[model samples]
Target: MRLSVIAKVLALPVVFFVCFFLVPLSVVLMSSLWVQNQLSFEHYLTILLDQYHWSVIWVTIKLGIYSTLICALLGYPLAWFMIRIVSTPLWRRLLVILLIVPLFTSNIVRSFGWMVLLGRTGFINETLQNMGLIERPIRFLGTELGILIGLVYILLPFMVISVGASISRIDRSLEYASRDLGAGHWETFRYISLPLTLPGLAAGSIMVFALSVSAYVTPALLSGGRVTVLPMLIYQQYSTVFNFSYGGALSIVLLLATLFLVAFANRLGSTKGGDK
Candidate 1:
């Protein structure tokens, strides 16, 4: 293709990105750097150097990493079952609908549902208490576990869909040949199937991690004001304190961190895929 043709092809998306993303980000960046109508780095220093902020960042990263790992561990088998085991088209369609139905509902509604389930008098606690699993109602509403459970539920569909698509694209011939050569199912999966699905796994994991890190509604509703994540902090600055500069700083930091982690994951996935 001619250079001009290629440029024309890219022009619309480039313009769209600049207008919608770049412009707003530029404004935030400038706002973050300006203090009392003068250029400064104090906001960045305040966020980065404070112990409370560090704890919040740590909590955010922990939530993201844990959620991603849990999703992958659970999603892989589910995806395999969907792609390779369940051969009935009708059942597969039903399963796919079940996976996606949660997405149609608002995040608030979903989080509220979890809150009901995890509350002191919630069904889960009552059942467990009645069954003698615990003497008292365990606290889940204001804890890390509560947040994680909600995140995993919300993010599992993404992982399953991504990995299922990848698994569907793999060559069945290779697996059959491996089996013919007397390789066990586990060996075939280890050497052929798993490697082939790494790209999808990586994509899904990154998506889940990014969303978990930035998640506000689920954590806010489930946390009951006890747990704090970066997004919540940013929200507080913008909503309660009316501090755009600090909020902008937090937003830029989050954006940069997400970009860096995603880029690293993409590079790692590409390298592993190439090796396989």
Candidate 2:
């Protein structure tokens, strides 16, 4: 009777997952494999063999890497401050709310906001000029750097939350013990805290990287029609060209690539955890 009750509780979600995600995904997979009412690998071949597609993939991967690195660099310190340094629960809650509030806004709106700030005549450049840091405005729009800035801004909250959760779970007594043993602060953090947080860092990196690569709106607006990513190509195939076969193929390739990288990250995290 208990087992039956548990199964009943899980039934709705299982049915929803099958009906929404798996079924649509299966349709896409079938579409990718079928061309001209016949099974063919031509679309996949076209994407795999083309140098242009490779370049777009490289760019997408590059942006993902850059975004992940930037987010990690910025996130770790902020997470540490929030989790370890902030002693007041109220203050910590406030900070967390501030960090997450931006996420509630639309991505398109955020991207547009960055556009205004990053433009040549924008606030950033104007401030730099006023500070005499630069004689002229810098070009941020239509460049990878601009896109990176937006991606980092959008994804940093995920990293912060992930790392903060890990940090909060750590045993403070361990750090106290290390300090009692004459270990310096740097030594305590480097040897004890950092290793324990590897899994969280890895998880956060995976989230940031995956979102960065597949992101469309942020990249599309920030790129200013200058740069291209895999999603953009896929969108063109489906929406503009009406080539669902090729679009489905591109979608599958991106999905597989993201899954591969995520798996690699998870394995690496596990290995690191074991070593520690």
Candidate 3:
């Protein structure tokens, strides 16, 4: 009776999941292949055969990786500070509010902010000019550097929130245990705390990487059509060119790539726990 109940309980969710998630995804997969009187690899083959498309894919991946790295480097310390160093709850809440303000804002607005700051008459250029740091205002908008900055700004909160949760959840006794054993702060962090936080870091990294790779708005606005990304290509195919099969193939490519990365990160995170 108990086994029957358990199976029935599981079956309901499985049905719901299939209806909601799997079915829609299946539609896309099927559509990606519906070309020229049969299912075929022509769509995917077209994606791979183009050198320029490959270059765009490479650029997108590189930008995602770079932005994720920057987020980790900056977010770790900020997370640590917010969770550990800030003893007052009110102050911590205020800091968290400030961190989230940017996240709550739309990507268009955020990228526009960057557009202003990076433009010729903007604060960054004006400061440089006043200090005689550069004879001419450097170009940031409509460039890879501009896109990178916008991406980093947009995705940084994912890193901070995930890492902060991990930092907050860490048992303080672990640090005390290390200190009791005559370990200094650096050694304690290196050997004990950091290892425990690996899962959180991995989680944050995956979020940043996936979002950065698939991001459209920030790149579209900041790149100013000068720099092309995978999302931009997909958007163009679906929106402008009206080539659904091509867009579907691109969507599948991004989805599979993201799934591969999540699997790889999960494996690494599991191994990280074993190391402790």
Ranking by TM-score: 2, 1, 3
Question: lDDT, candidate 2, residue 28?
Answer: 92
Please give the distance, in angstroms, between residue 12's alpha carbon in candidate 2 and its true position after superposition.
2.2
Winner on lDDT (1 vs 2): 2
Best candidate, lDDT:
2
Cα-based lDDT for every prediction: 0.94, 0.94, 0.91
Angstrom error of the Cα, residue 46, model 2: value is 0.4
Assess every candidate by TM-score.
0.95, 0.95, 0.92
Scanning candidate 2 in windows of ten residues, the lowest lDDT window is 267-276
- In candidate 3, where is summed lDDT lowest over 10 consecutive residues? 267-276
lDDT of 2 at 140: 96
Better of 1 and 3 by TM-score: 1
Q: Taking the candidates one at a time, how many backbone clashes does each contain?
A: 0, 0, 0
- Clash number for candidate 3: 0
Q: Judged by lDDT against the true structure, how good is candidate 2?
A: 0.94
lDDT of 2 by residue, 65-85 (tens): 999999999999999999989
- After superposing candidate 1 on the true structure, give the runs of residues whose Cα lies further than 4 Å from its correct spot: 1-3, 266-276
